[model samples]
Target: MPREVKKRGRRQEHKERKAKTTDHHQRSTKRLKTDHTADNGNALEVSGDAGDDFIGFDIAQPEGAHELQEETQFHGLLEPQEQEYYANVNNKIVANDFESAEDRATFIEAVHRETEGKELKVASSQSCSRYLEKIIMLSTPEQLRRLFSKFLGNLSYLVQHRFGSHCCEMLFLQAAKHVEKEHNKNASTNDDLASMENLFLQAAEELEPNMGFLLTERFASHIVRVLFLILSGESLDDDIVKAMLASKKKEKLDAPASKESELPENRRAVPKSFRTSLDRLIRSGVSTLDTTYLRALATHPTGNPVLQLLIQLELSASGKIKLSDENSVFHKLLPDPELEEDSESAKFIAGLIYDPTGSHLVETLVKQMPGKQFKKLYKNVLKSRLRSMSKNDTASYVAIRILERLGKDDLAEAKELIVPGLPILVSRRRTGLIKVLIERCAIRGVDLQDVADVIRSEYTKDDIDFLSALLDFKRNGVQDKTQKKGSESEKSAKSAHKTDVHGSLLAQAILQTSDICNLVQDSLLAVDVSTLTAMCQDSASSRVVQTALSPTEFNIQFRRHFVPRFYDQIATLAQDLTGSYVSDALWSATDGLHFMKQRLARDLANNESQLRDSPFGRNVWKNWAMDIYSRRPGEWQALAKGQERDQPQGGPQQNAPTGEKQKSAIELARERHAQKKSHSTNRKRNPATGANAAISTNA
Candidate 1:
């Protein structure tokens, strides 16, 4: 059995590291001139000798790690009075208690006046830096320009400062939008101000020489990550990328908005120069560090994320020059196009497979490497290890990444390896690999029945048992039973919670495949009302229920049986945080069931006060359109019936009358109206040709 890697929150570990090293300053390294790219071409397949006996570099330190020496810069501390005033300002910003927009602007302006010329001091001060973040968070484009100009030359030093890094991160994030705006020549553009693009490019240049060093530095790594993202026109909203930039525990400053602005989902348009700068940044990383130090970065806690992003940006570059260039980061990491199993590069790949930090780099490599490299690696390495890799906690994520890139035939082979392990994977709550496999099968149009059959066999075709097993319902009960005392019990509870989440996610993923979702749908329909209601009230399982009722997933028959399970419990569900979402899903699920829609709506109406009292319930009420149902029920019913009606099949002829079918009163009235309008138009157009308007109208 592979040792389970203990996964804890890296954020707290990072904080402890910062506390230890914040006083230290890193010394610049003499750049190595050794070429890492090898031009060796050999037989494409791995040798049989490349098994467990081979030793790669030391897992602890691949190279001699450099220690950062403390370098002090004098930024005078804030006076007691100044500290108090800024603290007050921070409090106000946090509370956001301004009477009006103008008042808030005036207050911010006053604070800005006092903090002018002391930006560095304020940003570096632990007590006052949060205020600096808040200011940047709410700064106008012009104000941002002024602050950017002030911080331009000091970015090299400021980026590594513990408190100062937070300020810099926030500034870059806020200023990034302005750069996008300027690129599009929006209203935020100002001719008199320094261009955000130029300011950003200038900042990049200031840090360009240190870019390689920063990639491995604890604090500076995050700033460089954000800078590259902005320069490359990547969205900052990505969760993985965002997590790297800031801790979840970091205080959030909610800036008041005059109007909500949608961040671009796709890459924003960037200036031609920005792309050039991005290329230069990539080149700095590729050329600055030798292969050993770069490989060492694969496991460096602070550096691995930056390396992943660097790898991503390098491969994603449009010129495709890097893919062919032997000197590129891509080539340096894996010098052999065809990885021989016993080669150093192959060993390095193998070493990273189960190491927690290093495996992430493997994931990035699998995701972004060109098809040739991917196929070569897959053939040489990953193809043989899919089963064991999928079962290991650390390696399973890497497995997921590989599964995502496989073709249809490749996926079928992978299914062979992974499907047999589903029983073990479900037991371990390693459902991510399972989820990706099923999703890939769906996408690749491979038959899902193999995996579905495995599931059915494992859970023995009993719907509730299948669901309860997949949903990990027993774990929660076990957790409740176990949570009586010690640290061991707490650990059990946490583990159980993780199992619940993974199980719920797997269940939801299954529900998306209509053919294979039968087990889940049947289970949901057959489960008692109390059990169904309880599932909806819980957070993780609620998502499974919502996905089952999604418009595209299950049909009306499934929904008709499933939705009314909540008929007597609509009020109970609407009042819950998690259940409220299920209640909202009920509206979509009731499509084509007019009477059911009204009945559910009426239940919601009866509980109006209960819903109004709870925030979650109010959303359900609004989403259900209970107000319209109450005030104008006739119109509501018509709208509801129309919504529920099936789209006409074939054409108008299907709904058209057969022989002797009489039109309804409303239809006959509509015909008369059409005839009168036609007569009036004809009489008006041909009045001079002896057409009689009055006679035609009467007829």
Candidate 2:
């Protein structure tokens, strides 16, 4: 009973201890539950008493990270923002949301918002463009017409802006379409053109101080083209010019009118008819294109249309500026550049000559610029820059056109300009420029004596050289005549072979130009056949001889003199390799090809079989020209058709062949055969046989 009572006492104490331990735990659990419920699990569910302890475990990350990134890029454009913008646009388009002006305004605003940064967002642009295309296409004519004026105002900015360029192009096309639509209903183009012209005029006025920048702007260039198109009409101010000058905007829009200039300040003033279409509309005003406006577009990409438009305007014929006019004010337009300093006018033309786009402007200026303007361009700029300009392929074309238009006096002046650079142009093989210049001079009847004299002086007796030292000639417009002569020795002739090579190239080019061939021929005509024969035998000089004597060259009356005179030398020349080519040049001469054919045939008649067997004679007949001769083996004619028959006709039968001539031809052939046999026999004789060798030597 005592042990049981002790155990009971211990149990009672344990139970009291357990109750004490549970009391705090139950209170903490209840507090956490209460806290979690009140806060709605926004914070950690763990009680503050539990602190920040956590367990660690392995995490299984997502697979295909590379593929996920690649797949995320839309349309492969590589821009996420652009992709999103395009996607939004497509969604908006699908919903027919562009039907209302509000929708257009909203879309435009979105586009504007997206394009806020400096760099053009290509994606946003595409989206905006697509939206504009849809709106322009879906909108009614009334809607387009209403929006057209506002669009025109923003056109200058839109054309140059990257995102806006596409929209601007769409708008331009649509606006033109609307204009055409209005055209069918008794609508005057002037009304539509007036508004557009007014906008451009206003833009031009506002952008005047910054004309250079406006001209260069990618978008603003479109506005320039538009202005030019409006200017392409008959009268620019027929409708708007009445209010010009009085209303500044309208005046700027309308071109100045055609008027005669009486004052020095107004000498450069072109009549309204010669200016833009707007100019024709003005009744009494005048305007001129200044250096400032020209400077801006001289190098721009869209400069082609502007230049073409400028070139198309007529030059004022009745009252044009004369270069020789004592009181001319045109030169004053530019700051007078000193002799050492490049004139401003000169600088401008020179700049145009080198620019890729502006070079064409030089070409047009040559064709259309007045004599006074052209003279200034040539004397001040082009004359000094010929050497550099001649070498450039683009500039050379301009030089060609310029040469074609100049008078004899101007051409002679041009010759002096080229004299200093002639050798370099020759050495560098500027064939195109040389040919063009020579051709122009010949066709235009300019004296070739100056150039011919220069060439002759270079080909001295001792050495035919036009080296760098020789290239530097004084600009007196007269060639030196008293250079000491050297012996025409073999050494000198050999040295001249170098010049002969280039000379031949020059000659060939000269000969190909029909108009100039005669000039060159006349210049060198005094050279005798002995000199020509020596040249004709040479490897290089033969080309020159051939080209000069070619029948195909125009006005080649020289052929009649060449072929008939060289008739006896034909057989000898045809056998020489170089001479054979000279002989063949006759076959191709265009002037008197038939005369040459008859000449060759007549020579062939005299030496029938003998000539046929000759090496040089073999090349005279071309395979294509063979039909002109008979193929009969034994029916050799007395002479070629149209040629004088050397032998008299037989007594009773004029048409019959002469037996004596035939037998003589046969005997001559036999004699040649026997001679060939004897020669072969002599060569084959054994040298070891002394008696036979002595006999052969004696034979």
Candidate 3:
């Protein structure tokens, strides 16, 4: 019978092997068809090696199949060991499963065997029993009190040495899952739920350190979801949630290394693990200790989205989440107090402010923090944040936005804050902010003219000198007479007698005439020409007009009275004014000759003829002639002689009267001749007759 059974077994094995080979061939055929379908529509067209036709059969069998089948046939041989292993695992998972010490020992031994000396660090059966007993026997208050204290201690330790905390976390997580299952089975009170939560928290404290290993978003998300469930007393595991929170807190406190470094050595860097963990914990809805969390987050080597979200949450909780409040958060995030003299935080902050979404927040912060302290802080932060921004134009744009917000209301404070760093900004061609700052300075009574000088000295190549001059002209009066005179002297010395090549003087003269009108029309015109040019080119005409018209009261008074009278005087001597030498000389000579000639011509023949011509005509003519002769007696003789010389060249007039008349005429003529001779001698002797004689000299 034994021989027959052995032969039968061999035949059955052969048959099974044949069946297996057939099954492999069928699978191979199906695979071929699938591949053929993928490639084209045809099948059974074999390619490559036919020798490998049986390779599929080798892959189909399970490894050690024969040995496993033999072991299964002798299952009773290891049933006790299997049962013991099962019982041990069950006891760790379920407190009431193990009834005695011997049972527990047997289960542990089986677990040891099954695990092959691998660490079988399972919860003790006794500990499980004790935990169940406490849950059943203790009041809710007692359980919570014990759980809280235990959790705090465990959490502290976990935070200190997080890498070794994973094993503890896993054990606690299992316990939490078990508790959750139990709670679901029996509906419990809120207080009982709280007690259960405390227990989970205690486990979480032990598990916190392991959280640092979670790198994936999904893992962090899972942890966070679990935490939220715990907080709300939902079906999710609490221990896992607590572990995530504790881990996140530890992460926030950890110092991170800067991203820019050359050396690569094994040293602790700010673990990305911590950030992921925190993100997960937050998503889980874990309650944070606000002040502490914020402080810790603020100290991060780099910014974190999670921390930013946390701040938003806290601010929102405090009812500070308006548009303005949102802006404040952005500003706060900006690097301030200059952590590094030149840091990237400033640039990052600048970029944030530049974002369309963030502009409102920036505006809000400026508005809310309108105090000197805030201004100083903000200025420092802004400077540092923009320090490393290669796109200074963008930075400048952000700064402009900040200034615009600040200038609209708190201009003085804004000016004070920005003026000190104007040089640095100007060097970068950050005109947007510079312009806003300049406007603010004007509003704040700052003399921006000097600002140009300051910036020029500091940022030599920057084209801000013109702006400075503009500001200066606006604040102080445009013209300093003393300075102008000095400048004129210097200019004159430089040019000597050379005519102005550019007609600049003529242009200035024309401009001067119209400049007053322009000034009266627009006060801004009172500024330097360069400023006016800038305004004309870059600013709106309406704005210039508005600025000009701002001093309406003063302009009205000046135009009405002072201007007209001043112009009338100018008109009176338009041709014979100080600028004309010929007119001046002619005017002086005419007046002097009148005085000298009137005195000598007082008794001439024409004077008598005018007295004898007619009573009225003679009297009138005699008075005019006598009046002229009275002023200049010497000029009358010279005039009479000139007339005699010009008369026809004849011997004498034969219409002579008596000796007395002729003697009188002769006496008059001789007297005229004697006076003329003397006057002629005086003229010849007078050095003033020479071309070299100074016109100013009186001979």
Worst 10 residues of 1 by lDDT: 646-655
lDDT of 3 by residue, 1-699 (tens): 455445456888999899999887776545355664667664443222233311111112222222111111210122455446545554463554557656654554444345332221211122222222222121123333333343343342322222323323332333343344334445334443443444555434333333322211212323322332333332232342234333454322111112321122322122233334433444232222222232333323211222333443334333333223423333235424343325554444444555543433443344444355345535566544433331344445555555554534455544545567666654544445554555555444545555444544653244433323222222121222213334756444323322221222212221223222332233332335433332222222213322332223334433333222212221111121121121111111222233322332332233455334434433333323333344554543444333333222111222123352333436666777999999988874534556557664643
Q: What C-alpha lDDT values do all the predictions have?
A: 0.75, 0.47, 0.35
TM-score: model 2 vs. ground truth: 0.35
TM-score of each: 0.76, 0.35, 0.22
After superposing candidate 2 on the true structure, give the runs of residues whose Cα lies further than 4 Å from its correct spot.
1-158, 161-214, 226-230, 233-367, 376-402, 449-509, 512-699
- Better by TM-score, candidate 3 or 2: 2
What lDDT tens digits, residue by residue, belong to model 2 across residues 84-161? 765676566556545666666566555544543412234225454555454444444444454444554444345555
Deviating ranges (above 4 Å) for candidate 1: 1-70, 183-193, 246-253, 257-263, 460-464, 474-499, 601-622, 626-633, 643-699
User: Which residue ranges in model 3 land beyond 4 Å of their true spot?
Assistant: 1-360, 368-380, 383-391, 401-431, 452-539, 553-699
Candidate ranking under lDDT, highest first, comes to 1, 2, 3
Q: Using lDDT as the measure, which candidate wins?
A: 1
lDDT of 1 by residue, 1-699 (tens): 999885489987888789766443221122223233233322222223323422222223213333222336667898899899999888888888899988987888888888898899999998899878877777777888889989987887788888898899888888887676776774445677688888998998877765666676667778988898888877778887677666577677675644523356677777889889987877765575568867877887777787788788778865367777877877787777679887888889999999998998998889888888789899888889988998998999999999999999999998988887888975666678888888889989989988888877777545446777777665355435234324556545534553378778878888888779887888787666766776776678889998988867356678877777778788888887778888877776776777787888888888889889999887777667567677867756765665422212211122234564544547655776998999988874545324576667667
